[model samples]
Target: MQEEKRRGQNRDIDLDTLDGQIIRALQQDGRASIRDLAASFGATRELVSHRLRLLTEHEGLRVVAALDPGFAGHHVLTHSMVLVDGPVGPVAERLAELPDAVFVSMVSGAFPLVFESRHGSVEELHESLDWVRGLPGVQRVRVTTYSEILKGFFVSPERRQISLDSIDYALIAILQRDGRTSYRALAEAVHLSASSARARVHRLIDAGVIRISAIKSGGISRNRLAIGIGITARGGTEPIGRYLAVSPAIDFAARSHGNYDFVATLVGASSSTLLTVIDELRTIPEVGAIESWAHFDIVKEDYARTLGRVLGP
Candidate 1:
């Protein structure tokens, strides 16, 4: 019993620089070994080990082997944008408790709330929507079927306080298609030289402007239903959105405003896993007051590559 108490106490500390580095390294490659991280970061193995322990125990940060959901059986992918008109708290919390709801976010402008979920078929997706649409405070819902995916949102470089430029967007566009493209190859695509391309890539990466790496896929074709959900937030959207974005189950979460109060996207290994993720989201304390809808099909999944329309940084 004493040992259990001690173990619980160990999980409450904040992450330091070295720990953050560990996260960064894992972000680059989840399969990295402690030996590799220690050597590269100039930290002792013991130090690295202890830091890892603290991160998991105290910070509640986890190191999980995220797999390609498609490998597990989920074949359909979709995006849903939800808007809530009541207290965003209970609703967001309820959404977070979902198992398949891996991504949930709140936004500021047009559609305030959004979500993306994966499922096995359109019929099952419609069934899920029937439940979401009936939730209290839901204003309206829309759906988009994604025929193709231009990009997938992923980990970006750490943020930098520098101003952004159109060149940044150009660089992003090139990398979005092929993150591992060599500098020479990128230059060729964007009409520049190899050295220049190299410099730009490094600078952008360091500046938290972009991240270049490969994301695993299920090795199968993907089709999806994108859902747009609207709800009235009784409290506000920011708190609920922020909480959902940081959820451990979420692949990526963000805030946007339009027809919805917030927008988020989640991934799952299968339809059941997706449903489970959404169930978990529905349990978040902040989401007690909420509403949602399931998108029937995905029209387009541009992912973060849509920076093109955002006008560069």
Candidate 2:
């Protein structure tokens, strides 16, 4: 009863126009100051601060630093669809608890439970899949390994060789928890001057080692429809993948080596809105065949992972 009441209260927390503006601003720069946001919007700092607090407290808004998989030493990324023999809720709950799971959801399709996981190496990924196969309700699992991620909120297109020290790793750990952590706090934690800490963070961000952004808990709207798309291209996957990546409706798109040449995730306000996007995709000459699944519920969507796992010994 208490859990039900809590969920009811959460759903009742309405977001006004100011809330939307604040969210967008934070999405662009999660570390933006409250004073700066107020000045940009021409609103009172108190009002903006109050709204920001409410959004985080009720809307499940998280501002965190997300690392590039390749830059962070994560060599393998894969999306898995699981067919369950019995109740899917229990199986999905277990899957969400897995450390490597960056995203997990229940969808309305042949495969009910789907998840995306990251790994340090191919060997580690296989061992993780073996463990998943042993789970009680899992009947079958199909995996699509990502060769290149063309678009994703946490990923950067550019890759560069940059050396990171223990201090850098420590700063990354802190920011992963709270991207808005003050430079003073970071300096205190790392035993460095605030200016030095700020410089290091800027250097890391400039190098495309990490992205600081806001991550929402679920679909942006109550009526939002989320779809997973698998595309087979006529010639090469690059052109199709790049096209899908640029669409405003598509949040994630990647080139993969599996049953499908490319895979993407789309979010829209309604079925009609999503269908229109799909129609446009079909019109692309390079696109051959497409398979899509409607997501029913997003059980988990956290991207933060232990840096040590990827850092190696």
lDDT of 2 by residue, 1-313 (tens): 9666545544544446567677667767888899998788766666678888988898888899988888867789999999999999999999998888889998878899999999888998998899899999899999999998888878876867888899999999999999999999999999999999999998888888888888777654553468999888897656676678778878788889887888898876678888988899898888999999988778888776777775642
Kindly list the per-residue Cα lDDT of model 1 for residues 1-313, writing each as its tens digit: 9666545544453335576566556546543567797787776566677876665565543332222233223445555556678754455455555444544444333445554555557786787667667777666555543333322234342346555566655776766664545667778877878888777777766665555432322111122122222323445555556555565434444343333344444443245655665666566544543344443322222233234332324
Predicted model with the maximum lDDT: 2
Q: How accurate is candidate 1 locally (lDDT)?
A: 0.50
* TM-score of candidate 1 to 2 decimals: 0.42
Which consecutive 10 residues in model 1 have the weakest lDDT in total? 216-225
Cα lDDT for residue 40, candidate 2: 81
Q: Candidate 2: which stretches are off by over 4 Å?
A: 1-25, 35-47, 223-225
For all predicted structures, in order, the TM-scores are 0.42, 0.86
Query: What is candidate 2's TM-score against the reference?
Result: 0.86
Q: State the RMSD for candidate 1.
A: 15.3
Clashes of each: 102, 0
